[model samples]
Target: MSCSGMETVDELELVVERLMDAPVAAVWKAYTDHLNDWFCPPPWRAEVQVMELRAGGRALVTMYGPDGEVVPNDGVYLEVIPERKIVFTDAFQAGWKPAGPFMVGIFEFEPQGDKTLYRGRARHWTKDALEQHKTMGFEAGWGKVAEQWEAVAKRLA
Candidate 1:
């Protein structure tokens, strides 16, 4: 989708969007389910462990790259608004173990008539960090995950 001067801004200011093939509720569930089979990017698999759905709740999401190479990406829940929005940060793991500096993430669902305006935003610490993520194929990686999510959402919608 093209920019419409209506984009929301945040820390590192990274945003991605998709028109989900499924309904808003299904898409929202995919966003909340850390163990979702569709959360990982293409060519990689994921193992998720979601503890709760509230502020300070923990979620452990381990992404496995090619050949079962695992990279753990867990975080703490900052806020969750049912089927509308979710806020989390990469500050801790499932067991409340201290980890990396916080990277705030916001996922919002905007219903457009019969479609869902699915969006994801993540704020990194520095410009260099954001640039580093871009260089790592952020768009392509996340796009793939969105596609997977759409498929799952449609099936379960």
Candidate 2:
């Protein structure tokens, strides 16, 4: 992992950033409180099977397709920094059980005036995996989710 000022760039990382027109608290609330409402892009929905917001807690989720197909995501919360950051990984599950290596996501909210700078980074174990995720619409999908989150935050504001 390499950090340049407030930005980070790694060897095999996919990152998306946006300057949202909402406060940090509002953005954080949209994540912690209204995740299911905006976690997935439109036509797709997400269900949080289990989410304990503390460090080493569970973050099991499932994404349902428009036609009723489901995809399970087993992950753990690695670090939680209040309204600042959240680090989660699919390489391990609840109770620290090792699973197949996948993406480790880092979501950060930096206060900017009355708004927030939202950055989402997905690190993969291999370049191939990173490429695969890029091909899977990681940018568009995650960007959509962030946009939805900002809309929720604006509504809350």
Candidate 3:
């Protein structure tokens, strides 16, 4: 809880970050793989439909709701720098085919000595979607996922 070291994102990018007591490589693997189904806490299965870890790759994630409902989160890989950065988006599907894009996800990993600094940013296209995501309890939801990510990362560490 030593947030005195916390860094703020500029107004342009709208990024949110958190520190995890795990190594960079381990944390990267957990996110790259389908750890969500096991690590993400209750009312959420954290299922991964597909994940291809390379440029032009695709990842299909379904966030399961409390009552067995599914929300599709599809993204294509834009940049991949091992143990450092991953940039992807549901802005378009495979083949750059447009499908009324909604959001962009950027994950940047910085080495914090033995620990890792994880930056999770989701930039929605509009204020309404951002608001809807907040209404959906993004802080709680993503925060849990980060907690889950930490567990997985620690195991790998």
Candidates arranged by lDDT, highest first: 2, 3, 1
Worst 10-residue lDDT window for candidate 2 reads 1-10
TM-score top scorer: 2
Q: Over the stretch 8-122, how does candidate 2's per-residue lDDT look in tens digits? A: 2777888888888889999988888888999999799998889899889999889999998898899899999999999999999888899997789999999998888888999
Whole-model lDDT for model 1 versus the true structure? 0.72
Error of 1 at 140 (Å): 0.9
Model 1, range 1-157, lDDT digits (tens) per residue? Answer: 3222213265476777887767788777666663357877767888775557788888667877898688877788888888788888886665677777536788788876655777878778887777777778767776777778777777667
Winner of 1 and 2 under TM-score: 2
What are the lDDT figures for the candidates, one per model?
0.72, 0.86, 0.73
Q: So what's the TM-score on candidate 3?
A: 0.85
**How does model 2 fare in lDDT?**
0.86
Candidate 2 ranges with C-alpha deviation above 4 Å: 1-8
lDDT of 1 at 63: 79
Better of 2 and 3 by lDDT: 2
